[model samples]
Target chain A: MSDVSLKSMDDVYPQSAGGEVRDYFQLLKPRVMSLVVFTSFVGLMLAPGTLHPFLGFVAILAIAVGAGASGALNMWYDADIDGQMQRTAARPIPRGRVSKDEALALGVVLSCFSVLVLGLATNWLAAGLLALTIGFYLFVYTMWLKRRTPQNIVIGGAAGSFPPMIGWAAVTGSVSLESVVLFLIIFLWTPPHFWALALYRCRDYSRVGVPMLPVVKGPDSTRTHILVYSFILVAFSLAPVALGFGGVAYLIMSGLLGAGFLYLAYLVFVHRVGVEADGHAKRLFLFSIFYLFALYLVLLLEAMVPGMMVPTGFEFKV
Target chain B: MEEEDLKKRKKRSIAIGLMLVGFAILFYAITIIRLGGDVFNRPL
Candidate 1:
């Protein structure tokens, strides 16, 4: 649905009974923001430089704001479709907890505030990446790709992947292959992770006309894609070891976790029956979260204690 | 119900607004204090 349709239906849309502070906070999608914070923090820690404690705090804060802004904008724009979907119907905008105008203002305010503060706290490179992440999410993914094609997550995944790079750039003031490998790890992981959810919730997407992979390509095709993406994800997961950003500990942990991830994807692949498919997808989706977190946690540990694990000597300790 | 809802909304929005203003003030103070008298001289 577009702005015109929304305007036409404005009369039918329920007015918010007015919302609480928590309602507005809900618009930020705090769960997703936490992931953003964690990944970006790991990137900051791994980058071979130190930031002023105050400035470091500001950098993380700004990233959080930018992420929240993206979520607000997404909710604002997707409110209509969101109301139709089971999982998202309770969101602020759709549930009349917050108005579209309020959400839009919140997003714009947070986006500008985060970018400006980040630039002041860090450097132009990190700020620029932050700006791009916000723009890509609001414009490229939410507005354009989401409703149009099944490949939306494939490309839109880049938005989520940028946080770590922004964190890297915040410290090093440049992007390198090391930060990029981190980006690749998440980029490859998104499809399998999201497609698993889509496998279970294809009906929700179809009802909203969002053209998610399972809805557009059918569940079997989506499963195949999930398995293929899982293979790539496992490969990318171990790339940190090969690329020299991860040590033996990282390699061992990632290899073990990657094998587990591949097995879940295989389960998702083999299960064709409805209930069985949903079960596999649920398992895969949950495990994928753990898989990525564990990979990054190992890297963070290696950075904190180089004695524990030595990343491949891809970059020198600057 | 409507009256109570309206009151709750007013209180919530006001609280958030105040919180945001405070956040901004703190941010500005940190930047200004850290940068010292030369804060304005340095380009943001």
Candidate 2:
């Protein structure tokens, strides 16, 4: 064969440049999955009853897999919009590393596997909640609310908030007020956390037509909403203390951390129409992550060490 | 096409095989734990 013909054949049958395991792992949104795993671990550890160590490991693995499945499904559905945005354009599906059909198949298979294994390993209640979380993220948040309304993250945050409750149910076999409080803490924290990012990434959301708060409602209104949610989040973070689950350490930590969170939100609200404004929003966004993590960490520590959780001499009343 | 690409594909295949084997072993362990003493006490 001529060199020209061989070169043409090589061009037609290109060498294998395909996805690696890392690309598939990226489909799982590992950072978000890590947060889910941590919160759920706190839930499992804090519950009144004990789970066998092996079964606990299984439960957490299932929950983490369930979170990853939902993330893959979200990426599959959002690939089109993701391609249009600077932040998400590098995702596996958007970058052509993984096909949409492959992502969807992986998501569906893992969802079924995680739910079934969780039910077998732990209680059905935990499994059911895991299923609900995956469905809520895919159906309610990804398919419906995200495109339709600016309030997408507000209602959609419920999906992310369910992990600790599922973890609690894995051990206790039922939901309780403590788990609900944990759920509420995350639910309330999501808005300000996301809005801070939205304020700075306003152009990206607007270009892709995702209808984020800053895109639809304007930065001023979005700033106000962030401040309002920060207020509510700070107040609600104290619920564990009132509910008698959080100790003196939790109270002190929440108070100091909540004050810092609100201060950053206030700075975001005050600065407008400049790099300074975006800087404040970015700072709040980063601190908001730390705020939530520190709050949860303190709770987990208090649960782990009884000495750290000194009684506040406060009692719950109707 | 290239030597590097061929090596990557081989590594990926091995990783997948290991994952499947690990999953099967995990299921076996979970079943044994869940059944507790019942596995040995089963009827012959």
Best by DockQ: 2
lDDT minimum window of 10 residues, candidate 2 chain A: A8-17
On TM-score, the leading prediction is 2
Score each candidate by Cα lDDT: 0.88, 0.92
**Model 1 docking tier (incorrect/acceptable/medium/high):** acceptable
Model 1, A29-57: lDDT tens digits are 99999999999999998998888777877
> What digit string (tens of lDDT, one per residue) describes model 2 on residues A97-127?
7777778888999999999899999999999
Task: State the displacement of the C-alpha of residue A122, model 2, in Å, after optimal TM-score superposition.
Answer: 0.4
DockQ scores of all models, one per candidate? 0.49, 0.59
Chain B TM for prediction 2:
0.82
Give stretches of model 2 more than 4 Å off: A1-17, B1-6
Question: Chain A structural similarity (TM-score) per candidate?
Answer: 0.95, 0.94
> How many clashes in each structure?
4, 0
